[model samples]
Target chain A: MSDQQQYLIIASHLREAIQSGELQPGDKLPSEARLSQQFMSSRGTVRHALEKLRAEGLISSHQGRRSQVLLPALTQDFDSVVSFSQRCQEAGKTPGERIHSREMIDAGPRLAVQLQCSSSASVLALVRVRLMDNTPTMVERIYFPEEIASHLSDYQSSSGSMYQHLVERGVEISHAHSTVTATAADADEAQALGVAPNSPLFVVNQCVYTADGQPVWCSEQHYLPELASFSINNVKERPSPSFFTPGRA
Target chain B: MSDQQQYLIIASHLREAIQSGELQPGDKLPSEARLSQQFMSSRGTVRHALEKLRAEGLISSHQGRRSQVLLPALTQDFDSVVSFSQRCQEAGKTPGERIHSREMIDAGPRLAVQLQCSSSASVLALVRVRLMDNTPTMVERIYFPEEIASHLSDYQSSSGSMYQHLVERGVEISHAHSTVTATAADADEAQALGVAPNSPLFVVNQCVYTADGQPVWCSEQHYLPELASFSINNVKERPSPSFFTPGRA
Candidate 1:
């Protein structure tokens, strides 16, 4: 296995042991050298695995003492937008969607700028509520261009998972770009999310693209902070100097 | 220039032309072939540049019509954490900071759990406000381990940017992990940010590490979403069948 996968696997095994109560709080973990011997990994690899556990607040080694259990595990967080679907299945929870409204509307100046279509073009707009185990968690405002909207023979079933329908129609979703910001819930959003009016929420705006580079759909989703968020790891580039031509953004 | 940088430069040139009124709304852009010849770029490269401009609503091509200027361009977005400092300098805005409070406190169970230190250990905690154009934009709550905290001979000037101080102390800051979530401003946060209680804000939690993999400092920064946010681009992984041992997180 690759070093990355090796460390993560060791961390996962230790995490499961702690979660299963095989290793209680204040219990000492095996020595790093012993773990390296058992897993046939380098000493650095074992330390990395232990550090991963420590980063999650699971284990700690301090003041020349051996590593010991500190706290229980947390719900694993997801960074991808597909996490809403992937994490639910991982946790064995049923993921669902409820369509609140769908209508054909004129592509007004604002949305026309988004879909790159004329203002007179007809667009399919929808308001959908995503649920986890029947509890509403997110409210989404979605828009599709006229070319895609006109091909919806069974819009209801397809709306729940447009990816499946699109795949069957020979469309492959390749990538997406997303922006996340904070917002206060409006009355409509609060009602749909079952939160108090003006509650704080995360608003994620994304544009999905097909493999052929066509913009397929755009969505603005509002999520309760307690239920959803994202994380990222960043590396600082030590730019000795950057003198490339064009100096592009 | 590389293909990626080439397209961005062309798009930037167009953006500036539109912003300076050299290109007006409904003005026709030169043909892709013509642009390719002008920039000495491949046709595909020129097309990518125009497509980028179209994505930002600066220009658009309609059915069987030449590409024309559409809506003006939007503000360029940033995906990196250092964007706050870099963007302000680019916009010629003065970025400022104010230290509100600093104190040495016992690492309570809550924070000790985060720092991996004993509850009785001393930790340095500080609160500071970051400003842009003399307007309060964010409030930061930061903590440091005892070892690093004790090395602070001149904590005042250094707190503005811990990076410079750490570098001077033979420490090289490397990478960081961050989480983004939305929250309602508490009373203390509201007063610091000059906003109403319950105002929606973006809370960024970050753990910074040194080059040798030691955790250096942790900070929880609260930002007014209207002023600051982040974006990301993601790709859907097509997982082929896998039977490898040790499936890890």
Candidate 2:
């Protein structure tokens, strides 16, 4: 077989192992020397195979350790109104939330429109970094109105889900309109997400409303591309309606 | 004002102009010297403001020319099963598709599962680049079974919508499951999409099913981040369901 074909064979074998769950996420693969021995291939060929897997995001390499299988991207439902913590738990991973900061600020004209409040209205701005399996996956900045903000005093001290907290406070989430775009991470986002500057990020700008059609909050969530994916199901009857109404509430 | 504040003021003014439709897409702004004169700011401040706009994907600069406003990202509805051509037309831009290649190949194991056919079944593979106003925006590779492929003789000669063609041939697209992710573009994708190599791309993997619940086509669409965005509306009662069923057909 050609040298390229030989390396592909080795890569396919490793890929199959990953697919079959023989090598679970976070499990380290054997050392390159051991892999070379088992594959009966040269060290260079084995290295080539590993590189192929890395490009596909199947494995990750760290200094002073063998390559490890990466957790497959967490799938987020397009139509779900669940919290990040709930989604993570549903995927069989422990979810964590670290509240970086919380402060009350005057809602600016832009935010005031989204919140359906006056510009001078006080809004609670909460910055948080969400974690899956204790690894930072996304940074979220959420703004809540004064009434809802009053109930969130214990949020910082407690590790409870925000959706649950809102529910307990008599808030009924009706729907959310989300605009999903891709952009390079800014410096603050890079630091919070533990990625290099200018890394690609999937951004979701969401405007959430209450059951009575009152806008409740606006959130901007930035997720690492490698850690999250979104799924949507589209049918013919309801042709995709554009949720992004530019400059409209 | 501080020098930094001066530039920020300039950026906000330009941003307002873009948002208000005063500066339409493809319209060139005044020269840097003129901007400096108009805003009563230094040339450095004008350049800084332009850079900020560029970072936000609002404008593009060509060699030795004033920057021009970019067409805002085209928003695709998550619930719609519309053709790209129709979407572009709705956005008031001419849509074009250039078919690069078409061939028949044996369905591989991975593709066979998606197509719900035998691995030895013949599949028609087509490669095309989608364009907006004659500028390439995305590259799509689609696979179809023989039944649909047989009626696509005019696909190459006529600039028509594939979805329309299939519908005319009695193919009723029931629904499609789409997985969206962000990744760095490969060399081939970069070339086809007219983007820099390694540029971040929004990729959508779609599996289209017919009314009989049979998978009819599979497509991989790689979009330039600057050109497209996806929108989803999640409601409380009929919440968005997760379409990603791992390890399932």
DockQ of each: 0.17, 0.14
Candidate 1 chain A minimal-lDDT segment of 10 residues: A239-248
Residue pairs with backbone atoms closer than 3 Å in model 1 (clashes): none
> Taking the tens digit of each residue's C-alpha lDDT, what string does model 2 give over B137-233?
8789999987777877666433337887777778876566667767777888878887667677776788877644567789988788778776654
**lDDT of every model, 2 decimals:** 0.66, 0.69
Q: What are the chain B TM-scores of all models?
A: 0.61, 0.63
Error of 1 at B166 (Å): 2.3
Residues B1-249, candidate 1: write the lDDT tens digits.
876468667877877888788987557888877889888998756766665554333454353456776433433322124334445555666666788888999989977876768999898998888777777888888888888886665755522556556667876555555667789999988998899999999877877665444566788888888876665444343110000110111
TM per prediction: 0.65, 0.63
How accurately is candidate 2 docked according to DockQ? 0.14
Interface C-alpha RMSD per candidate, 1 decimal: 12.5, 14.8
**Clashing residue pairs in candidate 2, if any?**
A79-B240, A240-B79, A240-B80
Interface RMSD of 1: 12.5
Q: Candidate 2: misplaced stretches above 4 Å?
A: A1-80, A157-160, A238-249, B1-80, B157-160, B241-249
Candidate 1 segments exceeding 4 Å error: A1-83, A238-249, B1-87, B238-249
- Which window of 10 residues has the lowest lDDT sum in candidate 1 chain B? B239-248
lDDT of 2 by residue, A39-116 (tens): 888876786677556534456634346877653322234223447766676668777888888899999998898788
Worst 10 residues of 2 chain B by lDDT: B240-249
